[model samples]
Target: MNKYIVKMLSVNDNNAFFQLINTNRERLEDFFAGTVLRTKTIADTINYCEEIEQKINKKSYFPYLILEKESNVIVGFIDVKNIDWNIPKAELGAFIDSKHEGKGIITTTMASLIDDIVNEHHFKKLLCRISSRNTRSIRVALNSGFELEGTIRCDYKTTKGEIVDLNYYGKIF
Candidate 1:
């Protein structure tokens, strides 16, 4: 198994985070539209990290970074946002650096993180809304124990300005 260190996204990670997105820009553009658009430079990343830190403090958004254990490089990100505390559920989003694709990093990290999200946050369910065309992400979701629920029509807009359908998958705790 690939070793990793997962932790909350901290403001201190701005540089590494920016580099991760910079290197994976093309591959992340579609699924991570907002992130790809917001983190165009180190300055932008610093600002974004500050905002995310505030949200984390408010318990409104949870963003976690996955680092390669040996090198301490930021290789993947997982977000639990759109949290509805009444139902205690949140939306799940994730992306891995292109170079780390096919390495099972996301599947393993996400599975372990899901357990923590449930135990620490009291989240009842987690949903992943994946672009319909993104087979890689769908595979990761399924491998991480999510079930396909349904297709959401025109669920997301890409940074390139195209509206796309999404496949909704869910995992109940």
Candidate 2:
């Protein structure tokens, strides 16, 4: 396993948060399609950080930054968004730094997060939605014990200018 750690986001981590967004903008755009991030400047990251702070404070959404143990630099992220505490489920998404791709960072972070959420928070399941065309992402999902349930067509618009489908994967605890 990699020498990395995952922790919850804090309001005071402003600089670190911004750096993660700035540093991974291109990688994010590549993994996440239909991003209007090209038009948004760094100020956009500032605003997003503010918004995320409020959400974390309220417990409605949970986000984490992945840090390399040696450098303490954020090299990836794992987000469990739109959580319904009563429902015991969350929408999961993650991406490692492009330079660090294929290093099992996302997999380790995800497995660790799921263990925490299920054991500490009593979560019953974690679900992920991956664009069908993204074989790499789908591989991560499957590698982390997520089972393919189904697909939603036209779920997202790709960078290549086509509406693509998404596959739903789930892991039950």
Q: lDDT at 143 for candidate 2? A: 91
Which residue pairs come into collision in candidate 1? none
* Candidate 1 Cα outliers beyond 4 Å, as residue runs: none
lDDT of 2 at 87: 72
Residue 171 CA error for candidate 1 (Å)? 0.6
- Model 1 TM-score, all chains together: 0.96
Q: Encode model 2's per-residue lDDT on 8-87: one tens digit a residue.
A: 87656656766666666665774443223522555665566677779888877787889999999888778878688887
Ten contiguous residues minimizing lDDT sum, candidate 1: 27-36
Residue 164, candidate 2: Cα error in Å is 0.8
Clash totals in order: 0, 0
- The local distance difference test score of model 1 is 0.92
The per-residue C-alpha lDDT of model 2 at residue 30 equals 49
Taking all chains together, each candidate's TM-score versus the true structure is 0.96, 0.86
Which candidate achieves the best TM-score against the true structure?
A: 1
